[model samples]
Each structure stands twice: as structure tokens, then as C-alpha cells.
Target: MASDPVTLNEFLTERLGAGGVVDDPNDLLRYITDWAGDHRGKPLLVARPRTTEEVAEIVAHCHCHGIPMVAQGGHTGLVGGAQPDAERPELVISLERLSRIREIDPLNFTISVDAGCVLQSVKDAAMEHDCDFPLSLGAQGSCQIGGNVSTNAGGLNVLRHGMMRQLVLGLEVVLPDGRVWNAMHALHKDNRGYDIKQLFIGAEGTLGIVTGAVLKLTPRAQATRTALVAVPDVAAALALYGQARRSCCDLLSAFELIPRACLELAFEAAPDLPDPFDTVYPVYVLLEVAASGSVDLDAMIEHLFEHGTTAGMVLDGVLAGSDAQAERLWQIRERMVEGQQLRGEHLRTDIALPISSLGDFFHTASRAMAARSPETMVIAYGHIGDGNLHFNLLPPADLDLAAKKTLLHDLEAALFSLVDDYHGSISAEHGIGRVKQTSFLNGLDATERELFEGIKALFDPDELMAAGRILPRTR
Candidate 1:
């Protein structure tokens, strides 16, 4: 192999085709920035590898050259985890070309796929086999399976199906030094010591580049009932959730909390978005109950509405009569994110608290925000079933850019403080990328920090893979 710097592109093109090594700056634009446009970097080139062997070769070459590398999936990361570092020139290895459904075992209830396979494609394939991949998210159309596994993403179905961590049965990873670690098994019960695949599941591509995965699948739901219910407050929402848990048990798939501000914003962003209720409410719960077999899902949903209304927890609600209606109802929750984006810049935080302490945290956090900046809009909404809240803060319209910046900083300080007081996680689903590194490090204890550093050293001894992503950059 030639080690000359001038032949770097030649070497890459030799391992992969000429189309694989993207050295042109025009084509590099897409790989340099994240979906959020929050972070951007300048990389020497982008390597699109089709096979795990090609990925290993690229990583190994970069490792030998002392050049850091960033492994990117669909580039849908919120925390800039997929973005390369701007200060240092890094090699970005994109897995988009490796999109392929390797195998689907109906008997094993597993789907083996290349990390670059689009999430929605995997879901569609599962449905074809009379199964379901329950990890549904807003970016399902574009986000890749590898990125989902790397972040251990939590979506609407987390309450029933668990996060990506639970769904992933095995992984195939390219280690820092270009060695491949293949643990792509579909077994459910493995009592082997130290589940090696677990290390790379949520490591944010820091430990290694995820090449493929074997994900667990669930039986397809025959009947799904969707409803948008108005609640008096967060407490009422929690009460409704308790009733839902009692009535449906594991059959309840989704229970999202939607505050009035968030809904109003969504309406403003998308005027075509229909309003389900006649009157406005302080809070809302978008709940879905789904199950397979001959179970009467409608009866279960009706019973929940009855109990909720009887207990004065439900103010007003609308239930979908058809699959199309259910999809339309779901659009309200999905479009809420777009609404926030239309409202301009806002500080987004993914925090989780104990399910029981959610109401108290909301009230306490609201009061604290009021004290800090009464004009700041607190558009908090999230997967209430799993206790994760996207506590977003939108600055006042009157504030200038500088003022908005300060307000966001202050708002983050106040909100994260409240999260700490409640002993909640700083990041609920989004991994600690470059954006939250300081906060993540601040919240870490000395012992945990030492352990994290040790693990990073154990895998990425030279820190050439995804430097400054999850763990701080040593060099």
C-alpha cells in the first residue's frame, strides 16, 4: 500500500470505486453539516463505503495516518453527533452506500440490515413479513438504522417496545484501528460474559463505526386506536396515563404530552392542520392503544375515555374511526416539531424525570422560568409515557439576536438546574454530542468520568474515531 499523502485519494479509490471517494468540495457540502444546521465542519474528504471491509480499510488508513474519522449514518442527528469537528480536519466515513436488508428471519423475530438502511424501509419490510419494527420516529424516512442504534433512540413506541437499546439484538462494528467486530447474532437469550455489541449501541460512533445490526421485531398490531384528548393540566395527563396503564397494560403503544403553546404553534406553522377539539385546553394527551389477535381495541380505548372523563381528568377528546383518521391525528403531534422550527430559534433540551414527579417538575420549572424570563415561551412536549420531555424555550420576539442568545443561555441554565434538582437525566434520547459535551461532563461524577475515560481508551486508544463526540478529545 502506498503511504504517500499525494496518493491518499488513489488509495481510497483502489479499495472502493472512483465513485466511493468523494473529494470534490461541491459534493462535500452535504456531509459537512448536520440536519439541524447547528454544527458544521470541514473534512478533507468523505468516504462512502459499500461494504464493512471497505469501511475497515478506510478507518485503518486514517488510523495509520493519525487522521481522526467521523462515522455518519443518515446525518439526522440533533446533537451534531454526526458532524465532523470544524477545528480539526477529519475523515468522514458515510454508511449510506451500505444500505441493504441482509436477512429477515420471521421465526427468530429479527431483521438483519446494513447500518445505512433507511429506518422506514426496514419498517416497511417488517410489515411485508407480517411483523413490525416499533421504533417509529419523526425522521424515519431519512434516518438510518445504524444511526438509530448508535444513539439508542427513543421514539413514540418506547413506552411499549422500549428504546433502540432493547430492540438491537446484535451489531457489526469496525473498531478504531480498522478491525471488524462481528457480533451479529439473532439470539434472544445469550448469557455470555460482557455483551460486546452493547458497547457500541449508544456510543455515538465514538467506540467504533457501526456497519450492521440485527434488530428484534414485534408481531404486527391488528387494531390501533388513536385519540387526542384535552387535559386540565400535567397532573390530569398523568392521572389519565395511570388509567391507561391499568386498562391496556402493554397494549398501550403511545401517550404523548402536548401543551397548549406547542399545539398553538403547530397550528400557526401549518394552517391546514385541523383542530380536533372545539375549545382550547391547557394540556393535551395524544394516546394510541394497539394490539394484535382478536382483541377489541376500540372497547379498550372507549373504556379509557370513560374512566378519564368520569374522573374529571379528560376535558375533551377525539378518537379516530379509521386508519386515515388516525394518521391525520398523528400528524398533529408530528407537525408540532415543525411548528417550533417556524417560531424561529429555540433552546431544545431532552430531559427525563421520574414518571411520578413529572407534574411537580413541570410546575416548578414553569415558575422558575417565569422568574428568569416571563416573556420566554415554554413550549414543552414529549413522550409522557416514558417520562422524556423536550422542554423547549422560545425567546421573546422583541429581543435582538444578542439578547436571544443570552436568554437561551439563561433559560438552559435554569431548566437544566431544575432537571438536576429532580435528579433527572440531562439527555433523554439524544446522545451527548459536541453540543452537550460541557453540560454532560459537568453532570458526570468523578468516578463515572474515570470509568468513561477508561472505556474510551480501551477501544479508541489513539482517539482517532469520532474525536470530541461523546468523550472529550485527548489530543
Candidate 2:
């Protein structure tokens, strides 16, 4: 077992101040549940540490007492990795108070910030310096850098800039044993023996608690263009995406594939938003291009539209004539999550396969889901430039919530099975926090599973850091 809850709470209050510990049931409820509202578990106490030293001290004390700790950042995680179980007598080390942007080196093109700093704040800081942070997501306003680093988050701009791992230059982490590993160097080339920072990038807080990070920045775009194109099907979408990639090359910032059902949901949920194209097609692609040097972005986009029209791949295309119009067009893509909520419960999957299998994967998975649960609505959308797709399944709008859940589970299983058949990863950009832990295990072989467990054991011998997350439990 573990230490007594009363004793642990007392110790936390004594070591840190009374303000650092929260034991009230009502206040602890928010920390217990995940963003998806799917996983729920009450924690014994919540610890809000404001400094790196405070985090280290708390983790050191917990390590000495053999108490499990779950590091929470933003709590916007889809996985239950942040969920703390009161029965298990775990402590939640919330990094909310550690929010701070330490420094911004315009000459070096880097920014050092505390892990609790929100993603949007970093982006704003980069903008002030006439640079860009590149890492972005739907939850940028709420999600913290620590969680992004832990998950190695990838977003729409990943096709051009890359994922969180590529942007991160250095990190400060508190290991499971409570030892502080400070490698906050912003150097481009270190030639170190073993890149220690890579170990915790996507480890999901199982190995350590990320306290801060040094992030790389890029030049801000001088001109940009966005478009909403109506394609006949996924085949046409892929072809258009290829042509745009060849024409725009590195300038092609994002290429998103949105199914007709998703667009309809957006229109239904958010009535204020207007659809750009007059005629609706079966599939639509939201594409964007940004460049630093002055280029005829309008003419380039016009050429793309004309080529797509002549090839019969694009039925109709609408280019953003103004910056406000560009933002409005982008809003349609950004509101995908909000629109998804208008439907019934959603069992979402983020998977990545080979680019060639993108069309086949969607067709096979959607067909399998429809056959498994005929009433479920399949809303498909995501970054098509890369192979990642957000395959979301919603229960029937007419059915009761309970009945819908029963059907949703069956549909999820069918979808995961098809993804496995295609050799696709179950959890792509989203880390296997708690929601997808079981599915990750189901998709992996015995040897691969063993390797993951071995790696976990090597980093966290006692497994006190975010237990039952990323790794499946052996009962």
C-alpha cells in the first residue's frame, strides 16, 4: 500500500503552505475528471506548486513516502492520464501556478517559458518578437506547453513546421525519483551522447514531470492565402492536395480534409457561420499557404483553383479575398470540435497511416462502422497533407444518450479493427493518456508491448508517475 490520506494531506500542508494543498471534495472534482468528461476519479488531494523548486520538493517527499503522483497541465487532455483516484490515495501536482514566460531571445530565435504557460501566450510572445511558435491546436488557449511537450502535439501547420518535438530545444523535468534534470540549453547543435530531452517528449508524464521548456521560433509569414475547395470525393481531394504540394511546396502550410457530414454539423451547430461555396459537395478541403518573402499568393491560389476546376477534381473553390475572410474560412475548420458536440456522444480516434492508404482507410473504416452500427454518424476530418485523420463517431441524434453509448462502443471496436488491419497507429498526435491506453495495447503485438513496458520500467521503477496511463495494467 500507500501512506494514509490524512497523513499525506497534513504533510503536504506542512511542507508547502496551506494554500498549496486542496482537500475539499467540491474543489477536487474538476481535477478528477478529464476534458472529454469520460473518465472520472476523485483524488485524495490536489497540489498547486508555483515554482520548479516547489514541484521538486513535493515530488521528493512523495517519492520518499511511495505515494503516486499525477502531473496535470491544462486538464485539456483527452486521456485519463491526469485522472487521480482517491481510492489509490494519489496526489495531483497541478502546474497551473507555474505559468510564466521567462525570456524571449529575438536574436537567438528562442523563448524559454515555464511548462504551465498556455500555448496561446507563447504564440503571442513569438508574435511580439516578429516570429512564430508554429505549435498550435484547437485547445491552444487552454492547453499548456507541458502537456503539449509530453504528447509531442502535432497540428495543422505540422506539414510545414513539424511537431512539438522538433520545435522544443530544451526541457527541465522532475524525474520519478524527484531528481531535477535541468537541460535548458537553447543551442542548435550540442552533440551530446544521449539526447535526454527526447525521453520525456511523448512519455505522457510517466517518466517525469515537465517543468519548463526552451522553444525554437521561426520567421513570421509576410503573406498568406486560404481556400475552401469542394471536391467530389477523397480521391479528388488527395489529387488536389498533391498538386498544391508540388506547386506551393514549403509554402503549403495546411491541407485539411472535411467530410460533408462534418461541414453540415458545423452549419447546424453554429448558424452565424456562413458556408463559402454555393453548392455543397460530398467532401471539402480547407487549404492554406503562407510565405515570408513577397510572392503573388493571389495569383498562385488562382492558378490552383483554375487547375483544380479544369481537372474536374474541384467542383467549386472560394478564395479568401481579405484577412477577415481568411479568418472566417479558417473558423470553419477550427469549429470542428464545437460542431461535433451538437451530435450525440463522440468516440474519437486520431490515427496516422501511410499517405497512400488515406483514402482506403477512410472508406474501409467508415464502411465497417456503418455495418457495425447503422445509426451512428461518422464525422471524418483532419490534416490530409500528412496521413493523420480524426475519425470521429457520433451516436444517433434521435436515440437516448444511454442507448447511443451502447452502439458507440461497438462502432469504436470496428473502427479500431480496421485501422489495425491497415497497420495504422491507434493514437497518433494525441498521446495514449488514459482514454486510448487499452486500444493502444489491443493494436500492438506482444513484443512491442513488452518493449514499451520495459522502457516505462527503466524510467519509472516504482511507476508512481501517472500510473495506468500509456501503459496497460497487468492485473
Q: How far out, in Å, is residue 68 in model 1?
A: 0.7
lDDT per residue for candidate 1 within 338-445, as digits (tens), equals: 888876778988999999999999989988998989898888899989999998999998888889988898789878878999999889999899888888898999
Q: Name model 1 segments beyond 4 Å from true.
A: 1-6
- In order, candidate lDDTs are 0.89, 0.86
Clashes by residue pair, model 1:
none
Q: Listing every candidate in turn, what is its Cα RMSD in Å to the true structure after a full C-alpha superposition? A: 1.4, 1.8
Residues 144-226 of candidate 2: C-alpha lDDT, one tens digit per residue: 99999998889989989889989999999998888999999999788879998998998889999999999999888888898
Candidate 2 TM-score versus the reference: 0.96
TM-score of 1: 0.98
Candidate 2 lDDT (Cα, 0 to 1):
0.86
